[model samples]
Target: MNKQQILRNRPVGVPDEKTWELIETEIPEVGDGEMLIRNKFISMDPAMRGWINDARSYIPPVKLDDVMRAGAVGEVMESKNDKFKKGDFVFGMGGVQQYKLTDGKGFYKVDPSMAPLETYTGTIGMPGMTAYFGLLDVGELKEGDVVLVSGAAGAVGSVVGQIAKIKNCTVIGIAGGPQKCNYIKKELGFDHAIDYKNENVRRKIHEYCPDGIDVYFDNVGGDILDHALTALKKKARVVICGAISQYNSTDGMKGPSNYMSLLVNGAKMEGFVIFHFADRYSEALQALGRWVAEGKIKTEETVIEGIENFRDTFLKLFSGDKRGKLVLKV
Candidate 1:
């Protein structure tokens, strides 16, 4: 089996091609209560950036020379666990490798007929769940409210906007380019989209969300969030899912200048990690799947072929080069 390992060093800027070292190794046997998953698709997320750093987080950092951490949708090629069978498609936190041996800590059997196996690792999976709980639960979204989302064209953001629209909110998405902005508005049914690169985000926020934003789903939490903060209604809510913009900051992330808006508007802002809701993943997945079947939400995935491209593919999230949920076809 071929696996990618994090060679001796950590990255300073973006993870480059040289950052990972690919090696061939003998496939291992499955132990009792374990199964070997032959990976098909691996998920690339902005959160992975936090996992590489040596810091205190919800999860531990990857050790040097360890298999690169990731989530994958794969088939059970071999198994000893009574819960799984041969040829069962499953999803789990199975790093960037061709095959994984799991003791069943975080693995679930996937029904291929339910949806495409790849979708399970993206829209109907973690990203979808993040959008659901982060917006409706944490943000306390209400019907007829005005909603603004940063990183609005990516995985979680895209799902956030469409779901907000379904709940009768006028949604405005903030992305980097015209194509992304247009896709969110024209294709995803968002009420409006602001290309932060070309437009004054604060001005557009005021124009599109004339009633003022009642819920702000923040994914990219730097200047875009700062701009969104200035256009809040009284008793508004901000759900912090991620801060992609500040992840690679060399000088450290600057505090939001418009935070006083929260106090002035009598609003609330809170940060949440999705893993805290692991117990309710199934609930979110079932509801999101039903929405997809009813044509209420459309999911997008930007798939990059080959596990060898992991470094370049992962960097795409920071560069604003991907259209939707970025995944690797391993």
Candidate 2:
């Protein structure tokens, strides 16, 4: 039997148990061109909240009663596909389930020997790819750039800051607490960390980037993004990543009041979906894989032990209860 979390309802505020229900069904049969994967780790991200909305966006929303969409790494248990063999490790949009059966449309082989399987679902998978394209390509990061990153202890934001440092940029990170702030500074080697929960965000940013910021990698949007705008250098780039702060608002999303600062400073704010760079994934994977192997990039994952705990684990994204990647181990 396979246990899958099916979307029960579209959420208005924060998602809760009512949003999805776990149900068991027979293990699916692999067809002539299909494979069956027993999911090992299911990625829980802030972006999952956006995926459940019944609204137009970059990707189609997860339909009600369908499996809750997610990225996962697993081992192939049965396969009739020529491209995949039983026991091969793979990564794909496996959703929040104990097993997946597919024709391998978006799936690809992964090497567990290269890194841990769960790490692929985090740093070496979608979140890592997102950080690579969001910062280097969209932010146009350069050496000596003063980079500001919000949600710096979370999956995508964490990678963004580290890659900035690797590129010879001075990186400042914004996280929710002293512990997370210290994690970024002490563990991740960020030049400075602002504890957004305890400090005055604007003042701390001004203190850290006294002159101006060259790149701002935004993950937790809303007020922090507005404050970041006020400190942009001339021709600065703002990479608009996930907006965790506004994803669950019943009142509506907040727009930055300081957006005009972009015009004043001749800076640019751009948004992108990682799927647009699908063709270049190998570039990111190779670089991230190399950095991980060289000790230049570090990964921290909080693994919850069951598919049934999906909702509880997912809420960690908004509550700041977990640092780094949050995943459900099946």
Candidate 3:
């Protein structure tokens, strides 16, 4: 039997047990062009919250009674496709389930020798690609540029700061607690780390980047985005990655009141989805792999055991109970 978490209801705020139903069903059989994957690690992301919404956006929202859409790394246990063979390790949108059925579309092979499978779900996977392309391509990052990244201790934000440092740019990370702040500054080599929980974010950004912020990689939208907007340098680029703060709000998202600062500072803010750069994934994966091997980039994962704990483990993304990438070991 395959155990899966099905979306029971569209959440108004942070999702709870009532929003999901865990049930077991017969393991799906591989068809003519399909493969069966036994999921090993399931990625829990803030984006999952947006996916459950009834509203339309970049992609169609996940429908009712569907397996919760997610990314997972797993081993192919059965295969009918020529590209995939039994025992091959792969990654794809496998959902929050113990097993997945695929036709080889949107799935890629993963090598354990290159990096751990869980790392693919974190630093070398979707979150890593978001940080890489969003910072370098969208933000147009350059040497000596003062980069400010919100949610700096989380999955994508941590990588954004590290990559900036590699390019010889000054990096500032805004995290919730002192521990996370210190992890970014001391461990990840961010030039400055702001504890938004305790410090005045706008004031701290001013102190860290007095000359002004050249790139703002925003993951937490709301007050932090507003603060970063107010501190933009001339021609600064803001990358809209994710908005965890407003994802679950009963009211609609709050627009930045100080957005006029963009005009005054002659800066630009752009939003991007990683899937848009699907054709160029190899370029990012190769570069990120080299960086990790050279110890220029650091990767972290908070692994929770059991498929049964999906709902509770998912809440960690919002509560900041876990650091780095949150992954479920099934």
Give the better candidate number (1 or 3) by lDDT.
3
TM-score of each: 0.97, 0.99, 0.99
lDDT of 2: 0.93
- For model 3, the superposed segments whose C-alpha errors exceed 4 Å read none
**How would you order the candidates by lDDT, starting with the best?**
3, 2, 1
- Per-residue CA lDDT of model 3 for 97-197, tens digit only, reads 99999898999999999999999999999999999999999999999899999999999999999999999999999999999999999999999999999
| Candidate 2 residue-wise lDDT, 147-264, digit = tens | 9999999889899999999999999999998999999999999999999999999999999999999999999889999999999999999999878899999999998999998999
Candidate that scores best on lDDT: 3
Off by over 4 Å in 1: none
Pairs clashing in candidate 2? Answer: none
Going through the candidates in order, what is the number of backbone clashes in each?
0, 0, 0
For model 1, the local distance difference test gives 0.88
